[model samples]
Structures are given as structure tokens and as C-alpha cells.
Target: MTLLLTPVSLADRVEVITPGGNASLTPPAASTEPSDAAVETFPRTTAATGSGGTTYSPAEMDTQPGLQTMHFGAASLACKVASSTTDLVVINQSPEPLPAGTRIKWQLKKEGTRGFFAIIGELGGGESLVADDVLDGQAGKDDICIARVI
Candidate 1:
């Protein structure tokens, strides 16, 4: 009898929305193979107003930017042989705080070597924000998974 092994992989991306009405999307740029594996990291920034109606700099916001809504992009990863479980981790490396009710979307696709598979998931913490909130005070992280499918 031959024993089979299942493989797991992960990728990450970030979409940042600034208080000045500007938005940006960062896509995943790394891959993991049967022999070699790679992980990608993304950085983001946002501006916010203080209690006295003062605007804070990106660095200042790092301490406590208040809760903000962020848009995330779908990550693409491939496995040579399908596995029983797969996980995707999203890390918040921004200078602002992300409150609950924050949502993320994932999409799944499967195609050929050049073929592809993808999944999207959303998260909400159910929290609120008040004035004088720290720009980066509430940094948070979340994860999504794909399982039991070839």
C-alpha cells in the first residue's frame, strides 16, 4: 500500500483606503512549490483626523488611526497535488486601526499548470470607533482556509 500526503499553501494581498479618498491594491507576489516555498508580505498606510480636528501623519497614525474599512484582493496559489487542507493568512501592517465589521471577500478558481485556484473570505469584528482613536493602535490579523476539494 502507498501512503499519500496532502499539501497546504497560502498567499496574501491588501487594499488600503485613505481618509483623503484614495485607494490602492497590492497583489501577492510569491509562490510555494513542492521543493521550494515563498511567502509574501504587504505594507499599507492611511491618514486620520484627531480629536482636535488635527490631521496625523502616517508615522503618527501608526500609534492609533481609528477603525477603518479595507478592501482586500483575491490571492492565487497552486498545488502540484491537491491536499486536504489549505490556509491563507492576512496580516495588518498598516498605521491605522481596523475595527470590527470589517469585511474581506475570496473567490475560488481551478484551471490547468498555468491553471489556477482561488478563494475569498470576509471578516467582521462588530466594533465601533470614537474620537481620539489611535491611528495604528488597533492592528489586527485574520485567516481563511480551503479544504477537502481537489
Candidate 2:
């Protein structure tokens, strides 16, 4: 016995064939564009003005210590600190939901003014992390460690 097969193309549908006969066609569902809220950007200050007539410009600030990019499951994250303080900030830019129990770890360097310090904190219900004294001193190059629990 001999078998022969013929291929057919439909305008916008997909078809399959079994030995019995041609299978029913079902077009794929259309995809929707992601919402603007799904996308997020890191927050950065061009310059900071504090009490005692102190001003720190981004250009003048030293390079952030242990700067690294991280992904928490489906969410994207970036970590950085000011040149002057122990305060560290992490930004989440993932489209999927990020619950309050996620955790992230990264090496940090405390430089500039405040001595190198290690920071560990947790993310709150509103998708923000709370810290005690993460970014607290002169801005320079110091290695630090930062971990966030989301």
C-alpha cells in the first residue's frame, strides 16, 4: 500500500490532519498589549539637598558600590545607593505580580562618607522596602551587602 499527503494553507487559521480526515480549524486568540502600569522604572535623584546647606550632585557623587541587576522570580530589580549615605534603594520593574514574601540578595560597598555597612530589609505591602540607615554618610566607593525580602 502507498500513502500520499497534501498540504493546505488557510488565510488565518491552522489545520491538522489525521488518518481519518482533515481536522477542524481554530484561529489563535489575539494577544493584548501590556498595560503601562506593568512597566516600571527606577527612581533616581539628579541632586539631593539636605539640611545644613548640603548639596550632592549625581556627577559629583562617587560610583555606587556593588551595583548589580537582579530578577526576583518574574520581576526585574536594580539596586543602588547614594554617594553619601548607607541608604540603599531597590527598584522592581516586572510585569507580573510581586508578593510580599520574595527575597533578594546582593553584595554592597559603603563608600564616600559613611563607612561600609551591610543592610538587610523587607519589602512592604506597597512594594517598597523599609530600612533603618542604609544610605547614611559622605558619597564614595565602599563595598556593602544588601538583601531585600519582598
Candidate 3:
């Protein structure tokens, strides 16, 4: 897995916030993923308490920067920030094509807790999902955490 901590002004159209003293990203953090079949997620909220385990990033960046790609199983995951309130733009750009009727799993995490803002639907080789706002239809959370796509 990959953990990105892109440094940017919080005043910009996008704001990235990590825990105190976690304002940096170098070589991306080391995170482990589920086995080839099962998928799991950890939120920034639970990052500090050792809740999600030691494989997750302590900081979260705006997905608005777009397309953080990862390879696992039979596909490559391309995650992008559509908007915090709406949903993410996940594309399958696998070098090896997935089998027919293949589906992918995804989850967007939150901060200070092991809860999810949205649990997206399984996507196909050329499909996407919109993980609507979990904050009761208001704006999305500014915590801007990480996601698990498999």
C-alpha cells in the first residue's frame, strides 16, 4: 500500500491534515493490504490508537490531487478525488485484464475512529462509484483520509 502526505496550504481549494507533527510525506508510508481476496479498511480517526494496526498511514492527503495508483491481485487501482462530498473516481487500469464479471471492493476511511464515511460498491474493469457524503448531506469531512481499493 501507499501513504501520501503532500504538503499544501490548508487555505487552498483542498486542505490536507494529519495528526500533529505529521506534516510530511516522503517515499510514502508503508501500509499492508488484505490478502488477494479479502479487503479491509482503517480510518485516520483510529490511526493513533493503534486501532487499524501498523500498516496504515498516520496522515491523509486530499484525493483531489487525483489518481493514486496501486497494484494488487489482478488489477491496478486508480483512485482520484471527485469531491469530498460526492464520491471518488476509481478506475481499473490493470495491465492484466480481469476475468469476466470481476468486481472490486473499496472503502473510504475517516479520522479518529474506525468508521467509514462511505462504503462504495464493487466496481468492474471499467466501472466507478460515488461514495456519497456520510456527514448527513452537508459538506464532506475535511480530515481527508485514505482509501482501500481491491
Candidate 4:
């Protein structure tokens, strides 16, 4: 099967689970102030004002066939599937490296399960992660993919 690398904005779907709870990771609109739910989720993230302002904010990530890429703050997680095995490609884009063992998970929701089940998945440790197997034949047409970085 062929998969197109279409960029989709996962504004409300992406989340980061922290010790406090699951916090929404969607970056706020530039024109408007960030809502309370749009707060930073990673603890090691830079909170100080920099040349560009607050350095940490969740941003939407993209995915393609056999691979999905997601981000939170300065961390990036890429989920790839090949030969029936899924592997997570983690890269720390931030200056400070993310601590090892940060929980990262990628899950493809089962088709027609109303978001209650996952058909295929893999786990890894990182600073951020996302899951959306667009051409994996396991996700529904209108499925909402959730990438969780704990």
C-alpha cells in the first residue's frame, strides 16, 4: 500500500502525560494567548524567556506510511514499522538531552473501535511520541490518533 505524507494539524489530539496528569500538548495560536490546557508538559523543558520567547510549546507532528513523527517541546519521536516489528526513532532536538527512560508510546487505534482499542503498537523511552498509521490498514477513515509522551 502507498501512503502519502500529508501534514495534519493535531491541535487537540496530542497529549503528554506527566506526574500531575495528562496535559494537552497542542501549541496555542500565535495571535491568541495560550489556554490553560496548552501549558508545557515536559518538566525539563526550558521555561525561561529566550530570544523567541518561552522556549517550550507543544507542536503538531506528521506521519506517513510505515512511519509517524511527533513532537513536544524540543523532543521528537518517530514511530516506524517494518517486517511486522515497530521501532521508535527518538531524537532530542533540544540543546539539553532528554533523560533516558522517558516513557514513549505509539498506538494505532483499531478501525471502528471508537478509540477504545489499538490494533498495532510499540513502546520506547523518549521525550515525545505520536501514533498515526495512515496507510497501515488498521486505522479507521476518520480515526483520531493520539500520541502520548509520558
Candidate 5:
């Protein structure tokens, strides 16, 4: 016996729009195999409201060892990671303020170990914050899954 399979064709270009910003994604060819790395995705129009008076969405999956952008509602986080160190720039464009008690937990996983960490960034209406060269020995170049709702 033999088996056969067919791959579906994808569009040449696709645009992902969230409250934070827009990202263009180009999918691989139909004949290509699925990638082992988890691709980062932007949240949709809907959002989850947290107890700290903030609305957020799940962020990106950092698979490679470089800079990646993660969008959470009106917050845009640009993270540059290398060797467990991260440089972050968070921006809030929503009309409502992000309270101080809000927490952004990041789930980090690598080849040998897996753990979680949290970071807090308070922002008023249309404000931004920058944290550079922050070290987290738990992070690695494998996967980082962020959750919604602060």
C-alpha cells in the first residue's frame, strides 16, 4: 500500500493587524514542511481585561536569538534577547492607563530547563518605557510564550 498527500496553496502576502500595530507574514510554499520553531503571532481584535485596569493579549514566541516584536492590545514590546539578556521597549497607545500593579509574565523554555518570569511596566495614556540589558538566566534561544491579561 502507498499513501499520498497534497498541500494547500497559501496567499502570497498576509497582513496581521492588532491594536498595537500590523505585521506582514509570508507563509512557506505548499510543498515545504512545517517549521520546528514556533512562529510569533499577534492578538486579534478582542482583548482580555486584567484586574489592574489594563487590557492585554498574548504576545510573541521568541524562537531565534535576536530581536522580536510582541503586541499586546495597545502595548507594543520590542525585545532584543541574547544569552539570557533582554533589552525591551514597551509602548502603550490605548486611551486608558495601564496600572502599576499589572504584571506581564513570560514563560521561558530552553534545551535543558524551563521556567517563568514576570516584568512590570506602568504606563499612562500614550506612554512608553525602556529597559535595557536586563539579565534573566532562565531565558534561552528556544521558546518564550507570553500570556494575556497582564
Candidate 6:
């Protein structure tokens, strides 16, 4: 099985669960103007700033296969997964002194289910796991994979 990485637009809105409630995060390439949803849901909007804290330079990051870029205080964390063979290889492409806890979790939508229902494996900070199949104990290859930093 092979998985191709898709680069999501910086303008694309990313929703996350924050302390206040549901907050919409704006990346480096996000829009300045506010959205109608934000206007209607003032308190819910909370903060619209980039979740990465610092901006990412072009030379630093891009939409590469199995590569997940995360922004820290002054350092940029690049999680790269080697060739997408039968087992997926996830690597840490950053400098030494890695963070204590940086985990990435993934969820897959079942085929017959209406949407993403099944839960998959998760990677924490500098840890790597073998991502063979999508669903738990299944060998199917038509599952939708969605990943998030947890």
C-alpha cells in the first residue's frame, strides 16, 4: 500500500479543541479577514493566530509524503516517514535535543460507515510505529486516513 501526502493550503481553516472551547487556527498562509462563522460565534473563535507560534520558511517545510511539519518556540519539528512500503516509517527530521512529548495520532474512516469512525495508531513526539494496515485487524486498503497532533 502507498500513501501520497497532500499539502493543505495555509488558508485552509483548521479547527482544534482548546481550553475555552472550539478554536479555529490560522497557519502562516491564513487569511487576515475574519470569517462569517467567526463573526457569528465570537467567543468560540478565541484566537485565530498561527498555532505553530513562529512562521515557517519555504526552505524549512513543504508538503512531502509522510512528512509532518510542526512549529515550536524557536525550532521547527519535521516528522518524516521514509518510503511508504508495506510498513510505514516515521522519522524525526529535526536537530538534536528533541522535545519531550510530541505525538501524532491518526484515524481512519471505515468503508461501510458513513464517515471516519475507526481509530488508528498514534505516534508520540520522537517515537515511530509500523503503520501497516488502516483499520484495526483489517487488511483492506480503501480507508481514509486523517492525522492530528495530540
Per-residue error for 6 in candidate 2, Å, reads: 79
Candidate 6 residue lDDT tens string, 8-66: 85766656678988654543334876655432322332333756544433344423335
- Residue-level lDDT tens digits of model 3 in 1-150: 999998885652433566686544443344573222433454544345635555445665535324444455666655544666454555656554444333334444442322232323445566555544433333344534444433
Q: How would you encode candidate 5's per-residue C-alpha lDDT over 1-150 as one tens digit per residue?
A: 899989998875545679876643665445565553444556555464555544555686646324333445665332323443564334555666666655443333342332222446556766655545443444554444332224
TM-score of 5: 0.28
Give each model a TM-score: 0.18, 0.30, 0.28, 0.24, 0.28, 0.24
Estimate the Cα RMSD of every predicted model relative to the unseen true structure.
27.2, 18.1, 25.2, 24.5, 20.6, 23.4
lDDT value for model 4: 0.41
Q: How many angstroms is residue 98 displaced in model 2 relative to the true structure, after the best TM-score fit?
A: 2.2
For candidate 5, give the lDDT: 0.47
Looking at candidate 6, the ten consecutive residues that score lowest on lDDT are 111-120
Clashing pairs in 3: 45-111, 45-112, 45-113
**C-alpha positional error of residue 23 in candidate 3 after TM-score superposition, expressed in Å:** 51
lDDT of 4 by residue, 17-46 (tens): 789786445666666644555455565565
Model 1 global lDDT (CA atoms, 0 to 1): 0.30
The local lDDT score (0 to 100) that residue 95 gets in candidate 6 is 39
lDDT of each: 0.30, 0.47, 0.46, 0.41, 0.47, 0.40
lDDT of 1 at 124: 25
- Model 4, runs deviating above 4 Å: 1-72, 86-96, 110-147
**Scored by Cα lDDT, where does model 3 land?**
0.46
TM-score, candidate number 3: 0.28
Best model number under TM-score:
2
Clashing residue pairs in all predictions, respectively, total 22, 28, 3, 0, 0, 3
Q: Could you give me the TM-score of model 4 versus the true structure?
A: 0.24
- The regions of model 6 sitting more than 4 angstroms off are 1-100, 111-128, 131-135
